[model samples]
Structure formats: C-alpha cells, structure tokens
Target: MRYESIVRNTEFSRAYRRGKSYVSPFLVTYVLRRKRGGVRLGITTSKKIGGAVQRVRARRVIREAYYAMGLNEEQSVDLVFVARTATTRVKMQKVEKAMRAHLTAAGLLSR
Candidate 1:
C-alpha cells in the first residue's frame, strides 16, 4: 500500500508532541500511533543541514530509505523523519540501515 504524506503543520506538531522518537547519527524518527488506518510519512530537514540543495537531498534520502523498507499496509501510525546535518554526507546504505533500526525498535516492522 502507498503511504500518505502528512502535509499539515498541525499534523507534524501533533506527532512531535505525542510521539516516541528514535535518534541515530543521520536521522531522528518520530512515531505516533494513529486512530486512522495506514501509515502517514513526513520528512523535515533544518537549515543547519545546508542550503536548499543539501536539504532536498536529505529529504530524498530519507524518503528513499523509508520506501526501501517495504512496510506493511496494516500499520496505523504517523512517522516523521527529521534529517540531521550528517545525513547530507552519509551513504544511502547507512541511511536505510538507520531507518530499519528505528522502525524495528518502534515495533513497526513485522519481522
């Protein structure tokens, strides 16, 4: 199933206020259980990461990593992936690994 994007500022705020977070060298993930079915994903990169190009790259990397994980459709959660400055310099494999680790820790991965 395709994951929906969490586009509203309030949605991000809610997740930040009520979610559990996991931090790695490259990424910080916030997971909030939602009453709605299916998963929603949000990605954010701060200016500290770099200019527009670097920030966009960081968001793309995070998005690709989440897509690579192949999460099941039954998960009912909202996820926010926050990119750190390190993300712009890290390899894709490391980013994917970090995403998996965080998802597993949050019990979102079926296996």
Candidate 2:
C-alpha cells in the first residue's frame, strides 16, 4: 500500500519485538496488527550491506520485486524486509524468491 501507513504504524516497535522470524538467505520479520484495512511494507538494509548507495539499492531492489510480484498491498501484514550481505550482489529474482518463500511460509501468500 502507501508508504505512510508502513512508516507511521504506532505499534511497530512492539510488533517488532514480539514477532521476529528468520529464514535462509534473509531475515524475515513482521507484525500483523489491526490497521485501517490493508497491508503496508517496510524495507531495511543495514550498513553491513554497504554504504548509502548500497543500502538504497537494496531497498530499491526489494521494493521493485515486491511491486513486480504484485504484493505491494497485503491485508493486516506489516512487513519489514531485511537484507543480508549475501543479497548485496544477488539478482532481484533471488530476493523475490526469498521474500516469496518467507511470505508463503508465513501463510500470507496463496498458492
């Protein structure tokens, strides 16, 4: 959905602490809360990934893949996508696959 909803969540801090799960190749964490009526997504890249450009690129890649996969809006899912060092040089497909796999595992994706 819109970036504002994802960025301005009041319960993000608590949700972050309570619901944190990881998967191979990336760290998948999320908090499902009752919000307006849709899902908002956030992407995070630490310095471990790289400098500003690298971090920005990582965010852009994930955001692009998320949009490309038509998963920009999800109901009740506040997602935080963290990129690991391995993702720095990887292609968008891998990132998309990892994200999709995680989403599927989380039961957010249907078939």
Using lDDT, give the best candidate's number: 1
Lowest lDDT sum, 10 consecutive residues, model 2, at 1-10
Q: Mind giving the per-residue lDDT tens digits that candidate 1 earns over 8-100?
A: 999999999999999999999999998879999999888999999999999999888888889988879999999999999988889999999
Clashing pairs in 2: none
Clashes of each: 0, 0
lDDT of 1 at 67: 81
Q: How much lDDT does candidate 2 score?
A: 0.70
CA-only RMSD, every prediction:
1.0, 2.5
TM-score of each: 0.96, 0.80
